[model samples]
Each structure stands twice: as C-alpha cells, then as structure tokens.
Target: MRKLFSYVLSLCLLVGLFAFNGGTAEAATGLTIKDLAGRTVTFDRTPKRVVVLSPGDLHTLQALGVQVVGRPTSATPVDASLQSVPQVGNIHQPNFEKIVSLQPDVVIAGTSFLGHIQKAQSLGLKVVITSGSSVNDIKSSITLLGKLFNKAQKAKVLVGKIDSKVKKYSKTKTKVRAVILFGSGASSLVALPTSFSGDVLAKAGGENIAASFSQLKDYPGYANLSTERIIASNPDVIFIITHANHAETKKAMIKLMSTSSWRNLKAVKNKNVIFLPSELFAASPGVKITNALDHMNKELLKVRAKMKK
Candidate 1:
C-alpha cells in the first residue's frame, strides 16, 4: 500500500511540472515575423537594444521612442531628442566590431544590405530588412517596426497622423508641374516621379515633370535630363534642393536657371523658384517631410496668388 501511494505521488508531481513548463513557454513574450526578403526574424522580447542601418529606419525608431543603440555615420544630427545616439559606422561598410560591442538584439537594415544579412546572422544577430521606395513602403515599415517593438498602438497613432496630413493635402486639385533639382548645372539635374521624392511631391499636389518620360528608369529617384529636355518639359514651378544655405542656394539656382534656356520656361519667366533645405527633402518619412510639404504649400499659394494677378 505504501509503495503504491509513493508511486501515485510521483506521477502527480511529474504532471504538475510538465504543466508549469508548458505555461512558461506560452507566456514568453517575443514574437517572430517575416521581413520583406521573406526571412524569419525572432524577437526574444521587445528589442531593448536596436541598431538602425538606414536613415529611414532611424527616423522610424526615433518616432517610436526606441533607443537606437547603433546607427551609421551618415546619420545627421536629428532633433535634440536623438542627439545622443551613438554611431556605429557607415551602412555600406558596417563596423561589425562596433556593432558586436553594442550587443544589439535586433539590427534594422534596408534592401541595400540584403547581401550582408548572412554576416549579421553569423554574428547571432537578428536582422530586419526594410524597403522604402514609396510612401506606402514607409507606412508598412512603421507597422513592422511597431510589431517588433511591441508598440503597435503607438505606430498606429503615428501612421494615422501621417495619413491625415497626406489626406489634407491630397484633397486640393492644384496640380503644379514641378521639377526636383539636386545640385547645379545641366548634368546635376535629376527629374523626379521615379524616386521617393516624387511620391512626396505627388502626394502634396505637385505633378512631377518626368512622370510621362518613357525613357526614365523606375527607381533611384531621378532621370538624367539635358537642359533642352528640361526646357521642353517647361515645368510651372521649379523646386530646387540644395546643400548650401537657403538664401544663397535660392540665388544660385535662380542664376543657374537664367543662364540656361530655362529663362524661356514658364516657371523661370514667372519667377517661381523655391529653395528647400536639402536634408529635409533627402529621404525617409518623418517630420522633415511634413515640414517640407508645409513650405511647398506656402510657396504654391504664392504661385496661385501670382496666377490670379
């Protein structure tokens, strides 16, 4: 009888232990998701230490209130809030040593780093490769990041605000023919509508001049156009992005346009030259893009004012 009782007690204890282990496994918080490249990445828990390899990813992480443990050197001084984040190295040639030192649980990269995904994995680092070509891509990236950080609610709110802002601008039917020029001279000219900048312009009520050009490539955001082609396009509003100070770049661009056949274009003749901060217009979806839209809107309103005269 005593032996039978002991055996029953042992069986009950084993069952209880198994149930407890199962519950612990189920309670573990980290979830796994597939990235754009169809690679499965697991998050043991909300990534506390994250390394952002792309500027767009950096901006998204910053917006999510996640501390970026590492970033590339090309990252500019962001808002005062993110000034303290440390740089790991250039994204093109990431400093693996530095990255390991940071001990980031998740490394955020872009399509540009698809080849290096294995290197990250070999180092026991989980990676997420994001693709940001259009505004939709940016929205999707925000959603993925939200899930990774367990901040789905915050991501939804941020994306909603972005959508609302975009909707507010989209309601206007004012389609101004605009050209996005980076740098000076004819060779430096790049036609938009094939780039992320084009998406932003289109969303903000500007009709990109290169959208109809059959020869333009689909991506990289610009078409090499000759002065003749630019003059032929004859855009109504000329928006130039420059690294130089706003006032100086504006003067230089106006001078450059006067020297070219652009003087004959409607935009030049009407004096519709507007200069925007180059960095703000460069890349990614963030407050900079929103601010750029506001600037563009104000400039477009002036153009409207002139047209009414």
Candidate 2:
C-alpha cells in the first residue's frame, strides 16, 4: 500500500512540476523532481541528450547505461562510452556557448555548480542537480535517475548490487578509529560524517574520529584540519585521498609525511597511513562505492589482524 501511494504521489508530482515549468498540461512522458537547490524541475520526456558536468553524476548515468551527449573532458570521464562526447570546459568552468550548441534536453549537474545550472536554465535548458554527500543521498539519487530515464529495472538490479556490496563490506564491529583526509600540505581537510567517504569508513567497520565535527567554520562537509584535534583524538588509521595523477598524489603524500608533527601521530608512527585515489573519496561514492568499500575493508581487516597479534 505504501509503495502504491509513493508511485501515485510521484506521478502526481511529475505532472504538477512539469505543468509548473510551463510544459504541456498533459506531458507525453515527463517527471518532476525537486533538485538539490530546492527548485522544482520537470522534464517533458525522458531526456535523450544529457550534458553531465560532475564525475559523480556521470558515473550514476553510466551505471544506468544512459548515453551522454556532452561532458567535461578536462577531468577523467566516467567510462570510455562518455569519453568521446563533447567537452564542456572543466569542473569549475563550464563553456556556456558549447553547452548551448549541444542543445541538450537536460543538463545533469552537481549542486556545487550552481552557476552552470543558472546559465543552462537561462538558455531554456532544463537542469537537475544531483550532488549527494552521504550514502543515503547517493542511493536516492541513483534510484531517482533510474526512474527518470525509464530504466527502473536496470536501476533495481544496480541498486541491489550496491546494497549487496554495502552489506558485504559493512562492519558489524568497529574496533579501529580512522580519519580520512583530503587535500594535502597546508590546505588539508578532514572528512566529516556528512561526507561520502566518511560514511563508507564508518560502515566498513572503522569509526570516523571526525564525524562529530560538522560545523567547522567555512567547511561544509569537511572539517578544517587541526593538528591539535587530530593528535588528541589519536586515530588508529589515517587514509589520505589525493587528486590528479598518481605521481602527483604520491608526491603530496611524501610532503604530508615529511611534516614533523604529522609524523608523530599514532597512525603515522604505527605505519597505518593509507593513500587512496580521489575518485572514490573526494566525490560522492556513487556506483563506485563498492570498490571503495572493498579497498577499505581489506585494509581494515589487516589492521585488525595486526592489532590482535
């Protein structure tokens, strides 16, 4: 009964939001959803031409096997299928003229790029923001995209797979305290409970030390790194997420470890420092959550074994 009501309510919202968008009173095939920015957005039909700006959004679309017409070439694409698509600047800078040239039916974007959303809407293009910070948000966005693209069946299978992975990797007993760090050098940031990686770490049987520090001044989903807090917390594991190429990320790690104060931390002294790719940490876990969890689980198990020994 609840499922039926949800379906009916979704259908009504789809109709209502589309109509509010000035679309045909009776859309041939459309759905309405409130975007991350709290704007009601509607699509007249399942969008065939999509312009993706965020890698997380691109990966979700890819998981649903949705073919994109445009994406940012400046960063790594979701897969080979989306690699050859037209480039729309980079993550921070979008090329409005190029995006307009594509005439995409809808632009799948992240909440971080509000400027891009405004520009696309100004040019009469429907925009949807799907940036997710936590595990639930990522899962909800996945299901929503699946519904929007009429790929409900595929979405179900994909969603099931994600759930299976989460269950398989999730830890029932957390014995290790961890702190997932992003960026490096003086600009280091700590992943809070609100961040995707932080949730993964907690679920993977590792307690996130920084989970309670949400309101860290200017940081939204992250806590401004304070050596004093970290040293006092005395985390058992320190996982660093780095960006750009492997060489660059490795170099940054070298610099991070070279810091005399950081070297004195318990995690550093015990050689529990782990480095991971930014793909799974810096962005919303998306469909790649499984991969990230698998990696963390392996490391956590090793740490547990060592501690027992």
Candidate 3:
C-alpha cells in the first residue's frame, strides 16, 4: 500500500509540472498586435531588443522603462541612460545597414515613413507603426505600447494624467480666438484643427482661426493662409511653434510683426504673441504632453485675465 501511494504521488507531481510549463510556453509565444498601418504582427515572445526609428517612439519606450538597443539620430537631447545607444538614423532616412546589424527583435516607427516600412520588413525586421498627430493619438500610442511591453499599469497612469489635465483646462469659460503657426512669418504654415498643436489649442477652449481654410494638398493638416486672412481674423493669441533656433525664429517673427502689413494685427498690438518651447510643441512631445498642455492652458488663462482687465 505504501509503494502504490508513492507511485501515484510522483505521477501527480509530474502532471502538475507539465501543466505549469505549458501555460508559460503559450504565454511566451502568443502575442499578436495591430500596427497603425492596419497590419497584424505576431511576436514569439516579449521583445528584448527594440530599435526606435523616431524620436517620439524612443520617448514612449523610455517612459515605459523599456531599454532599447538602438535609437533614431537627432539633435534633441535624450535620456541620460540612452546616450550610449547606437544611432540607427533619422525619421525620414533610417540607416538600414546599422539597423539590420543590430538584429533588433522589433523596430518602432511613425506614420510619416510608410514607404520605409516595407523596406525594413523586407530586411526581416518587424516594424510597428504609430501616429502622434493628435492628443487622442498620443494617448493611444502610450496605451498600445504599454500593452506591447507589458507595462499597462504605467501607461494607464500616464494617460490618466493627461486626461485630468484636459478635463481641468477644458472647463475654461473664456473662449479666445487663436492661431497656431508652424515656423514664422509668411513662410509659416497655419495649423488646421486636424493637427496635433491645433487639437491642443481647441481642447484648451481656444478657437483655431485656420480651421476654415482649405487644407493643403500635400499636408492635409496644415494650410497656406495668407497674411491678409490672418489679419482679418484678428486672433486674440498667436502661438508660434518654431522649427529652427528659438531666438532666431522669435527675432524673425518680431521683424514680421513690426512690418506695416502685420503691425496693426490684434495679436501683435496686444503683445499676445507667444513663442512656444520647441521641445514641447515642436515635435510630437510623447510623454511630455502634460507639460505642454499645462503651459498652453496657463498662457491662455493669462490672456483671459488681461482681456478682463
């Protein structure tokens, strides 16, 4: 009777061990997700080696506490921990050879590089595409990446922070007419409601003057609004997002504002022109969006207060 009991107990232990291992194996190989390009990607396991082809993706991964093997080349400062990571190239022109040599398990890209996606895929690199064009898109990217990296809790926290800020600022009773310009002066493109910065302005209770302009053919989210139309709108605030050096851009903008044609504009006359920080508003901003929202909201509030006075 003792020998028979021992045999049964050993058999049960073996079965339990097998069951546990099986479940783990299934989980290791069962991940499947869809990219912004409408393609389904399957992973054998959680990615251990990742290469980010855009600055925004790099920022997203960093926020999730995921270390990357390679990052896109940029003039902007990166986290201190990632300073040593290999640069695979910029957003529009990635260094394919270096990326292939890195042998990354996956590469995260943005929607602007659709043409390069297939090229990277052909080289046997799995590319996941994301967009950072709108506030919703930023939140969605954070959520999606959290799932991919198994950091759902952290993503939730970050997204919740953004939601709280939006809710708080969206309640502003003052409605200010505003215009977001990419670059400066006549060469600048006006942001439409469909753009990221424009979306933020709208969310903060500011009316986008360029919303009614016809979208540009090449860039649907921006338009070439004439100086005459801009003056006609007489926006309460003019938010300038610079692509070049901030001081230089501001100087050029000041020069333009002093011109007889633009000097009489309401925003110029009232000193309501604000040059947004390039780090927050120039790019997608990734996890730093909360700071951007706060800055814009505070500036708008000051404008409101001045209006009342």
Candidate 4:
C-alpha cells in the first residue's frame, strides 16, 4: 500500500507541475490562417524568407519589419531598408526560377495575381494573396499580414493610424461637392461612387457628383463626363487624375484647365482644380493611403477656404 501511494503521489506532482507551466501545447507541424480569398493557408512558423509581390504587401512587410527575400521589379524601394532587396519579376509575371532559388517560406501577392499564385503553388511554394481595393480592404490586408508574421501589435498600430486619419476627415459639418476627372483631352472619365478614389473623396467630406449617373456604357465604376455637366451641377471643387504618365499628364492637366469652356466654372475660376499625383491616384497607394487622405483633405479644405473668401 505504501509503495503504491508513493507512485501515485509522484504522478500527481508531475501533473501539477505540467498544469502550472501553462497547459497549452504547440502543434509540431504548422499553423493555419485565412487569406483574402478565404482559403486556408498553412505556415510552419513565421516565414523567414518572404517574397512580397505588390506595393501594398510591401507596405505591410515594411510596417512589420519582416524580412523579404524577393519583390516585383516595379515596386519602388520606398526606403533604404528595401533598396538592397532582390527583384523577382513584375506583379503579373514572376520568375519562378529566381523564387525557387531563394527557398522562401511564402510569397505575398495581390488578389489580382491569381495566375502567379497558381504557378507558385505548382512549384510547392506557399502564397498569401491580399485584397486591397478600398480603405477597409487595405486595413484587412494589413491585419492579415500581421497575423502571418506574428506582428499583431504592429498591425494594430497601422490600423489605428488609418482609422485616426479617417475620423479626422469624416468630421466635416457640411459635405463639399466634388468630382474626380481622369483621362486626357476627349477621354473625360470620372471615377464613380463605387470606385476607391470616389470612396476616399466621400470619406474626406467631399460628395462625389458622379455617383448620381450610371457608369458610362461598359466602363463600369467610371463614366465619361462632359463639360456641360460641370456647368450645370457647379461643384465646389474639381480633382483631376490623368491616365497619362509623366510630363504628359501635367500637360494634359494644364490643357484640361485651359479649355475655354471650363474656365468660366466656379471651381476652375476659384483655383479649385487639382491634379493629383499618379502614385496616389493611378497606382496602388498601399500604406500611403493615410498620407494621400491627408493631402487630399488639405486640398479640399483649401478650396473651402477660398470659397469663403
């Protein structure tokens, strides 16, 4: 009886020690997370060699201080830290040979790169696709990236900064009527209410005038706006984003504003016509959305002050 009691008490003491040590156990293999596609992606641990495929994903990685082994050639190295990172290929196309050589734990990509994802998966590579269309989608992407890298706290900080900017812009007592015109010469495409820029404008206390009209034929999220409508609606401000690259865009902006028909409008007359940067308006601003919103709000507020004058 004494011998049996000793053995049982030893077992009980071991059980108590284990319980005191925090009963949680890590899986020997890996962990699973949901990407933007809602697909379950597994990771052995936080990826050591990450390949980011888009600017938005780059922003996420930069925010978390995660190591990136590869990136698309087009992605502008935003800081000195990313200047030395190697390029794999363009977002739409990736050099599989180069990626395989790197032996990356996972490849981060934009939702637009489904083909890239398939190709990478075929080569036994892990990929996490992020959705980044609107402000909310960008925030979700940041959160997902944070989860993948175990940098949940950094993700919270990023989301908090974006939310703070949103709250600051959303507090306008009155909405300023605004229109975002794109294209050049006769190609006057306006961003619709459903579009990302349009959404940003609305959030920044500017009412998108183009929301009232149906998208131009097959253009979907965009409609060809005419100078006639500008005269009729008489918006408080006009923000233009041209499709052309480089100096041509600024020239087109000048040309658009120089048209005799647009000169008489109140927005044009009051110097409220703004030509936004292509980085913010044309391509994905990624983590730069916070700065973009701040710039846009400043421009809009300038217009408002001018209107008061």
RMSD of each: 5.7, 7.8, 3.3, 4.8
Clashing pairs in 4: none
lDDT of 2 by residue, 96-205 (tens): 78888999988777677776665667788787777667776777778778866777777788778878877876635658888888876557789887777888887777
Native-to-model Cα distance after best TM-score fit, residue 176 in candidate 3, in Å: 1.5
Compared with the true structure, what per-residue lDDT tens digits does model 3 show for residues 16-119? 86576443443545678987768898888778899998777787888899899999987888779889999999668999999999999888888877888778
Winner by TM-score between candidate 3 and candidate 2: 3
The residue-by-residue lDDT of candidate 4 on 119-199, one tens digit each, is: 778899998888766788888988998877768788999999999999988897346788888777556788887766887
lDDT of predicted model 3: 0.84
Q: Score candidate 4 by lDDT.
A: 0.77
Regions more than 4 Å wrong, model 4: 1-29, 75-77, 93-97, 216-220, 226-228
Leading candidate by TM-score: 3
Candidate numbers sorted by lDDT from highest down: 3, 4, 2, 1
Which candidate's lDDT is highest? 3
Q: Output the worst ten-in-a-row residue range by lDDT, candidate 2.
A: 21-30
Score candidate 1 by TM-score against the native: 0.79
Candidate 1 weakest ten by summed lDDT: 21-30
State the lDDT at 166 in candidate 2: 78
